[model samples]
Target: MKHQTSQLEFSRPLQVDRVPRLGSVEKLSAEPKELKALAKRMKLPALHALSAELRATPWRGGGLKVEGHLTADIEQVSVISLEAFRETVSLPVSRYFLPAGAVNDNDQEDDADPISNGWVDLGEVVAEILALDLDPYPRKPGEAFEEHVEIEAEPKPESPFAVLARRKGD
Candidate 1:
């Protein structure tokens, strides 16, 4: 397949097959517009900056080893305070992207990540990584969380032994 970058503002598609035998390294940064769109897609308050430095090393068998770090400044609502706060997110990424169906049964491989159509969309991958790394229940600095415990109103029912005792007394 002839690999090509998409027209989207945040597109970071890499043509793995086109890389020279020596391998390739890439640095990607998202513009303000792209960050805004990403924030909207991820349901965050705001996304100030998004950048990554990635290295792609190809093996003789067409498998690629991808290593990178993604950094971003984002604004999100704190679950504890219910207020917006800015925080920096940094994630180190590493994965193996094998060519489709390249693994043999005896190889005992993990195919969680794979190259598709000779291309890898670094932007999408970074976004997903950031989302996965985010705190599902974020809390602001110094925000206290108080868990409310409900107490049942009814008293405990009498046990069989207690009923038998009452009958014997009567």
Candidate 2:
């Protein structure tokens, strides 16, 4: 039997709250080597293909809107959700250190620690999101995938000196 495919168009309304700030510039700055590794591991070809497909589609709207979808794969959805969580947690961490007023100063050192005032918690959240394993491709609308929560068996306490310490016997 031959299956005929038909195109369907629909519109939905959505409201966006102000995007949450995530992290401080100093905190959000991923090491160049680390980013390169992540990009390499992601295997750009699939992403490139997806980008081409998305680019071919027309997006309607200026500011923002929300819509509901009928299907989605849980694993893929989890990855996207985790990424959004990372952004939300990271952006504010970055913004907390911004100097008062609109003037932008790249070299200002106020010595005020925003982390002491709850910003550090975001770092932990980011770390947790990064730890999860997720599928790269998910069914577009409705789909099912296994969900696994891997609890950190041993939580490592944060240390300011840890950054300066070399690996054991290094």
For each candidate, the alpha-carbon lDDT, in order, equals: 0.81, 0.25
**lDDT tens per residue, model 1, 28-141:** 899989998888887889999999998888864777777889999989899977999999988998867777677555666564466788887877778878878888788887
Tens digit per residue, CA lDDT, model 2, 38-64 = 334443211111000000111121111
TM-score of 1: 0.82
How many residue pairs in model 2 have overlapping backbones?
19
> Lowest-scoring 10 consecutive residues by lDDT in candidate 1?
103-112
> TM-score of every model?
0.82, 0.18
RMSD of each: 3.0, 22.0
Model 1 spans with C-alpha error above 4 angstroms: 1-9, 101-108, 164-170
